[model samples]
Target: MGLGVERFTTQLPEHLHCFVCLDVSYPPVIVCALEHQMCESCATELRKSSSKGKCPMCAQTMLDPVRTSGVLKRAIEDYEVTCRYTGCKWVGCLLDEPTHAKSCDFREIPCALCKTPYQHSRSVQHMLVCPEEVVLCPQGGKRCARKKRCELEKHLSDFCGQWQCRVVQGCDTRTSLANLPAHEKTCADAAARIAKLEEALSGRNETLATILTELRAKLDSLDPTRHASPPRFDWPAGQPAERTVSTCTLVKQLLTRATKRRHRRATLAATALLAKPLPSPHVAVLQESAPASPPAPALA
Candidate 1:
């Protein structure tokens, strides 16, 4: 009548069905002495009932419960089964039953936090207020209200109202995400002032460098070794007067020799003048009167 009954009837072959349970063997099929196949649950029940662990079908004493052959194992895995949960119509391989059970909408599972049973599809919604779940704090948990772990990063970065400015220096202002832009503008002004101060300091360094260069040049000019000549001896002012007197005597001797040479030249000039005879006025008059007697003397 139900889907599960119909699926079991159609999908599971009669040969693979457990002899005791009369259903398809899920896994761990047990083999008795007569090779009669049964589910492990039925085999375990039979062993407990009889003191000697006798097989129900053969009446033989069961020593060790052997597993079903490979052919039976494969056949059991390939058989299709309908979901056991009420109102679920899912039908697939027996091997895939566990996977379908985990996600089945009608199946109930215990919540990780509240420990209350919730349908698998509604488990996520119920976890929001589960008492056992631990969460993080908003505002990066640095100093803000606690929040769910899943929503912490988003709340801190996008929605927290108590977030502080990240500027570590020159400003210790605290502001919310809504006023962060205004605080950043203030920080920008402070940064600009610092840059101006640094530029002025650099200019002052350049001026100091120029002044140092000028001073170095002046010092080099004042160094005496740059214009030095050969050394000469200088007499002291307190030396003996005898050296000065000897210098004056040598000068007077040179002047006396010069005066004697001049007198000798004047004396030679006077002697040459006195050696010539002088013509008297009376002799000049007699030569003029005897001029006519000269012609008669030349004829004799």
Candidate 2:
């Protein structure tokens, strides 16, 4: 009854399902909108409706049925299927045209070194390490564009000899690759930094020694003077003597005081040495040699 129907029917084989209204004998074209048929009437109604007119049969909006072009429909029905590569999960129809090609990730790029197929990202990375991808010298030099690694080394040394050093904050001096090892060996800034470190260590050691010496001297100056001895007791005749004693007890107390002071000084010096960057060994030895009590005179 219509060209749209003819276009649709011509593409399909002799027997296939068609929309119920568009059959050749009863081409009455059942209405989805006023005087419209082929079930597309509902789509026209929905398109014109204020709130999107729905299908009269199901009361669902009919404006957006999926439409397939003739080419696409035939391709899907007749397409033979095979996966492009082993282990691919896809098992169904692959169109011969560029429909699937738009999304396919298997496209190839030529290797810059050898015009062989390689993936684009992988080929770029390979070029970074590939010797054959070497750039030719614009100057008419006898060396081939892809010079052997050994010959390239020699050529670069003789010609573009200024190789960058590996050091961070590197030396600015330019030298041939052959001479880089020697130049780095005697780099003056590196040597100066080492000298400064050595000097700082030496100065710290001297300061520690001086502090320890002064501490020992202070410990030695503790009082060694004698305290008052107990006075002799006078005795009455034939009576047991009532013995009187001076403050010998105080002398013992003084000795105790001196011992504690010596101990405190030794402890302080030990702590000071521990606080130093490098401790002097003599501080430990000196602390061990401290007298347990002051001299005999002080004790008495």
Give the top-scoring candidate (TM-score): 1
| Runs of candidate 1 exceeding 4 Å displacement | 1-11, 124-300
RMSD of each: 30.8, 29.4
> What is the lDDT for 149 in model 2?
34
How accurate locally is residue 196 in candidate 1, as Cα lDDT from 0 to 100?
A: 100
Q: State the weakest 10-residue window (summed lDDT) of model 2.
A: 1-10
How displaced is residue 41 in candidate 2, in Å?
A: 55
Candidate 1 C-alpha error for residue 34, in Å: 2.1
- Model 1, C-alpha of 208: deviation from truth (Å): 99
What does candidate 1's lDDT look like per residue over 140-179, in tens digits?
Answer: 4556666655566576667776655665464667666778
Compute each candidate's TM-score over C-alphas: 0.36, 0.29
The digit string of per-residue lDDT tens for model 2 on 127-197 reads: 65555555543222433354533346556756654555545245676666677777776785686798899
